[model samples]
Target: MELQLALDLVNIPEGIALVKEVAPFIDIVEIGTPIVINEGLHAVKAMKEAFPHLKVLADLKIMDAGGYEVMKASEAGADIVTVLGASNDLTIKGCVDEAKKQGSKVLVDMINVKDIATRAKELDALGVDYICVHTGYDGQAAGQNPFEDLATIKSVVKNSKTAIAGGIKLETLPEAIKANPDLIIVGGGITGQDDKAGVASKIRDLITQG
Candidate 1:
């Protein structure tokens, strides 16, 4: 399991500071949807500039204009960018093609997709790098669990990598790993804490143990 540390809703400088401190131990660093919505491609560019050696994912949550958004994220130096699974196949295909052209990866977010299994398979066929089984922030606040959701999504994805994102605490991390996903993503739990490096290390240890 790869640990994906997410910086959510923080200012650019603060996010970069955390990245500087904790990125060495993490496999992937995500610029969360809230951060991307707030700061746009400039935020992705800034993070890339700050951590030139680290892998960068722009969680743009592209629900529309997927190709344009993918292009923007790629030009801004994102190693990976996201498109909603609910988007039309053409949109997802466009983003995937653009990402391939830019030498970046594409993550299809199945946040609110009704037929996640079908969409996931479609994205896999379209050649996305990963299928993110994400529970929205509001969904988590309402008691949605990513472990169960991830397990189900994992069983459905044939060839695409799987990433789980939600309220991932240490206790539930083992369950996430038990699902044997390709990657695990966490945001507020770590970013909300004061000790970023510690949180990053703890997550890495869990991934190792898992």
Candidate 2:
């Protein structure tokens, strides 16, 4: 499994620093939606500069103009860009097509989708590279978890890559990893605390080799 550590809300300097510490350990570095919205594509570019070896993901949460968003994210140095699963089929398909032309991957994040199973199947048919079963940070604070949602989506979309995000901490990782998700995304659990490198190392050890 690939471990993606989400660095959200940290400024450019802090995000770069955290990546410097954790990039060697983790498989991907995510420039989260909040951070990207604050810093612009410059955030994604900066992350790519900080660690050229690690894959960069820009969580744009794109709801419209999928082609333009995918082009911008790819040019900004995002290997993978995300579009909301709640978006219309044409929009999602546009993003997927644009990503293909740009040689970048597209992830359809199922955050507030009414029918996750139905949407997962649609994304699978559209040739999306990844399906992210995510609960927003606000939802996390409200006691929502996508772990079970991950299982439900996984069952429906058996061929595509799967990822889980939100409220992922060290203690909760083992269970999430056991789900055998293709990627495990962590946001506040690592970036909101001290020892960013240590936290990443622990995640790397627990997920990939375990």
Q: Please, what is the TM-score per model?
A: 0.94, 0.97
Worst 10 residues of 2 by lDDT: 187-196
Off by over 4 Å in 2: none
lDDT of candidate 1 over 123-189, digit per residue (tens):
8888888998888888878888766667777777678899888888666777888878898887766
What's the lDDT for all of these models?
A: 0.83, 0.88
lDDT score of model 2?
A: 0.88
In Å, residue 8's CA in model 2 sits off its true spot by 1.0
The window of 10 residues in a row where model 1 has the poorest summed lDDT is 145-154
Q: Which candidate gets the maximum lDDT versus the true structure?
A: 2
